[model samples]
Target: MKKAIIVGSAISVIGLMLVSCSSTPEATTTTTRQTTVTAAPPPPAQTTTTTTHMSGSGY
Candidate 1:
């Protein structure tokens, strides 16, 4: 029982140390979590032209 208690405490301390040691850099961590999105602008208005030609002849 005593041995188990000592071992458990040691493991807990080691885990805490590892967690504290592995923090990500500020820039790197922020970039990975950042979300960037851009939407395309609307297309310019289109103009359509229609032409009609008519010929008149006596039938």
Candidate 2:
């Protein structure tokens, strides 16, 4: 039983080491982009003026 336990533990450790060493690390990069948006100003509101003449004005 003791020999079996030791061999099993050794196998588990070697398996973990092999898996960790065989994997490759990946490099990651992030970039930020700036964008400008331009919009035309709206036109001013129009106003109309009307003049009325009254014929009779008495108090």
Most TM-score-accurate candidate: 2
The TM-score of candidate 1 is 0.40
Relative to the true structure, how large is the alpha-carbon lDDT of every model? 0.85, 0.88
Q: Write the per-residue lDDT of candidate 2 for residues 1-59, one digit (tens) a residue.
A: 99999999999999999999888566669667889988888888888889899888785
TM-score of each: 0.40, 0.41
User: How many clashing pairs per prediction, in order?
Assistant: 0, 0
- Per-residue CA lDDT of model 1 for 1-59, tens digit only, reads 99999999999999999988887545544434567898899999998998897879868
lDDT of 2 at 15: 96
lDDT of 1: 0.85
Candidate 1: stretches off by over 4 Å: 24-59
Once fitted onto the true fold, the runs of candidate 2 whose alpha carbons sit more than 4 angstroms away are 26-59
